[model samples]
Target: MNAPASAIEQLQLGLPELDWITDPNRIQRLSQDFSWFSPVLTRQLEGKVADAVVRPRTEEQIRQVVAACARLKLPLTLRGSGTGNYGQTTPLAGGVVLDMTSFNELLWLRPGLARAQAGIRLNEIEKAAQAEGQELRCMPSTYRSATLGGLFGGGFGGVGSINYGPLAAPGNVVGLKAMTIEPEPQIIELRGAEAMRMHHLWGTNGLVLELEIGLAPAQPWLETLAVFDDFDAALAFADQLARAPGLDKREVAFLASPVPDYLTQLAESLPKGCHAVLSLVAEAGEEALAELVSAHGGRVSYRRTAAEVSKSHKTLMEYTWNHTTLHALRVDKSLTYLQTTFTPGEYVRQITELSRRYAGEVFMHAEFLRNMEGQTNCSALQIVRFTTEERLQQIIDEHRAYGVRINNPHTFIVEDGKAGGDLPEDVLAMKARFDPLGLLNPGKLRGWPVGAAS
Candidate 1:
């Protein structure tokens, strides 16, 4: 149970040119992520721990580590901030965890794009870009803590997805610099369609070193939390504002009754029975936002400028997205969540039916977003009242029967129920080309079953 000297010694033996960690406590912490958010994963991956952790300071050190792991056939799982909900950072094969935090650095900033090392905290990048009059296109709710590389590796989309679309959406990611696993690794700069091969691959293919991402012009935002007579109206108004022309917005989320009740920090602002629609609209568009809310039968419950919100040290975004699920879990440990996407015009109908069918079991929370084609849509991160694992799958089945897409968070395998769920040929082809040895994060990808590539 003590720190294993041999674990660190093996890494040192393999790659003597790196800083390594074998302290059992630190190794255990490095091996975990928010994957516990899913009860299924908690049960499945419980007690699974990494054997060692190797922290790389530069891209050269990463190359040396990847090459060593490939030679030793050690499953090297890449670790960013480990803010991912899936067990993307957990080493199923019990090998070396390649920690990337030390690689943090802001390399450069151009007019419409910026380049930075993989381990840089998103907030760090945002601050640098803001100083240069730009900001990240879209960021996950864990904005301040999550590294941009982790965002590309496991995240979907959040705050800025309303306008910039998902991370996989074209133009969001300009390019990525990746290093393949082999005796002598090579850093490959992937661009256009090629860069996407590594996206959401769960760091199973290669280690991302640096990324060149597209940026949006910086804007002063008004952090507004509005109240509504009904959940439906709040959602409808948010949808209207999402599509409204000339009105710029960053994040827009609709949280129903009990969901808002779970937020203790804003308990005084939100009415007891009222639903809430949280958003970060452009400061210049505040008038338009107010008009839209009034027209849709809602009133502004709380309003703060970005500067004011920052002063309070709480962001409305932290109250939306998976943050909503996290807050509820803080209050009641018995709840889990479902990641779902709904069609454009049928949100009302589908929401009504799901509410009636599951009733109090599944509570509705929708975050409005735009797809790759710039079409308006929403992904629901519904909080569920836990009964049993079988019942959870049944709820998922019911939703799928209604044509809703569920991105199963319970499973660590790359394949799921959606198009992205099934391993795409593009990624497979990329792996075949880059990771011929099959040493990087071996057990995480189902498509590349143990030694299948061999």
Candidate 2:
């Protein structure tokens, strides 16, 4: 059930001192994310919007909003930049959207580590870390506006994942400060593995206030693009770069034929009908990268030094990841996308086979990264030609039959999104302990029904 009308009034009256937004248009916009990427999700969440919004500028203000919402039993959905594509910030039950952007602040930065308020943008943290000769270990393509809490709550690793694996991999996140949802909020600090209990749950388990993340030494990365006439040759080159230990690389993205056609902004570098491999390698690895490209019969079509890239304010990082889907959608509104992970030692073969099996239908777009287990593999964000819901499910089933792991992005429920159908007992226990009333992002967590007691 949605929050009672009387309860919303009570919440507003209780937190009269904090910023409360009741404008319908702004509320509608704040209630949405990039979920429209999926035609399935777009229809499913068509009219879902929060009844009101509250922007808390400080930890104390956040406590007041949380405490009031808890007291009134109002369903509260936490929102950070709203850069996620899975409708993560969209509220299934109308109540209040807690906008965390205004609370942004970088708390501290030291060598190899940084702590910042949950609402701070990832780019801001990276800029601060760079001043200390360090950078974020893993950041999404939307890092320019994506928030720290948003990533920890709803994202997987990106760019730097090839070296450090995913964000969930140990050592990437040092600790975090969260608040328990109660009439009297309790500020709690969790460190090491314990802090991760709230990671990737879409902020349903607890309210993250500030995050402490691990950093990596800064590298002057050279952005380069390799274009090939052969699909097998392109995938092989990217896989080789990902596996090359001597090359200090940050990213290796493979875009199979026609997929590159959608990236109109890079038309000069992306020749028509060519499969592309985009990467960010240290200047020291320039020769090795060129040799590998030549060995695969792929030619370097684009080159930008780290300094040049900084001046242009454009990097190939934006062309990879989900941004590929955005560009594809811009070209064809009927197109959708899928998230799949190929088998570890067999990713290249699987990709080549699938590309052949579904040529002209599922255009290949893969990002190479080490898994949580430190095994290197390529995860695909393949572009799909939309036909019908049944066809989408059929494609998913076929990929599964071929041993590919599908992390379905069309669903909003936490359990349904993961390959696994249920959450861990420990994760549920964290939810029970932190949000007893289930007021935090209520409808998203499958294991714990809204308002169900521990």
Candidate 3:
């Protein structure tokens, strides 16, 4: 019914220097994430909560909190910004929640790389990088509020992924410093491909402290939307722009008619009964992009420079990815999403097949991307009109039958059989060494006890 007595007592008695939250109301708020985005996750984790919340202001305080939780055998869930869509921060098994937001600090910055405390907001990191003539290679749609560490831990890729690839791809993230849960917490520094061990583990393995990420030259990005009477024309224009040389493309998102209709903020920009392509292209390529759009039988409906967009606080990024689901949900609460990847060569066919079958029930929303192999491809964050759980499962099964991979957002687990399909042995092995007690974000991983993970 409560957290381990030893952990609570030791944390309360030993750490008077720390900020501990005992108020049920505040703790309840801290214990939640955007899990309500998924009806299935909402139903399962609606009432779950953490016993207490401990905010560690510094890395030393974090080590102390880890040592105490480890010694007392308390499950610890790490949270940052709480902007994640899945129940990545939900404490299914009650314990101490180590709030990492207060651990904000920019450690260092260079021309090609930047390092900072995990709790620093991603927008802050990008701003700091931009000041140095550099930028984050990729960022989530929730860039304004999402912490860089949380984004790295729970997110894969976003706007910049078109040019740079996912978080774990090559040099997107070059370094990571994590703290193991032990009586005397040990520090683990991961570099190169080794850091992939915790890239998107949802803070289930190691507690991230600081990160050193690779940077790209900051671009004068333009957020533009192209409207088309034919959905196929929109997709063709997007595909052409994505592979166009000398054209710097960040996000090339394709949305069917009603999808843009649900985007209340830009409803006027998108004509009724027309499909849309929301893109973030470099300022230098605007003329070429517009030309391509015209050639594809479409019109460039909306265009704004990054600085202008910042002044207006209107971003095309939010209309893509999972954020599309967020906007659609506001219009119709009975809607969900699926993370589907259509690999190179056959992705168009796969999308066409599913689109033909699902039709209006599952509206297509695609973000064109380049996979790790540098192949031009795409992933779907399609908005689904939720009917029943059984129907959802049937759709997923149908996709799998057609060799279309689907990552069910409705479930929260590191191993969703989407990316790797098989068990993540390296991640699990690292967890055993770092959190031998498996006390870090326990039930978030159904593969608890380590054996189940295998």
**Model 2 per-residue lDDT tens digits across residues 196-226:** 9999999899999999999999999999999
In the range 1-454, model 1's lDDT, one tens digit per residue, is 8875563466587676678787899999999999888899999888878788888898888877777777667777889999888888988778788889999999999988989999999999998899988998999889899998999998898889999889999888889898878888887889978898888888887678888999999998899888998767887787788788799999888787778878888898888867888999999999999999899898898999978976887778788889999999998989899999888777767776776677688888888888877888888899998989999988888888889889888887777524245577888888877788776777777766655534
User: Which residue pairs in candidate 2 collide?
Assistant: none
Question: What lDDT tens digits, residue by residue, belong to model 3 across residues 259-294?
Answer: 898898888898877889999999988888889999
Reference-based TM-score, model 2: 0.97
Q: Give the Å error, residue 166, model 1.
A: 0.3
- The 0-to-1 C-alpha lDDT of every candidate, in the order given, reads 0.84, 0.91, 0.85
Question: Which 10-residue window in model 1 sums to the lowest lDDT?
Answer: 415-424
Point out the worst 10-residue segment of candidate 2 by lDDT: 445-454
Higher-scoring candidate on TM-score, 2 or 3: 2
Which candidate number would show the highest TM-score if scored against the true structure? 2
**Model 3 worst lDDT window (10 residues):** 445-454
Question: lDDT ranking from best to worst?
Answer: 2, 3, 1
What is the model-wide C-alpha lDDT for candidate 1? 0.84
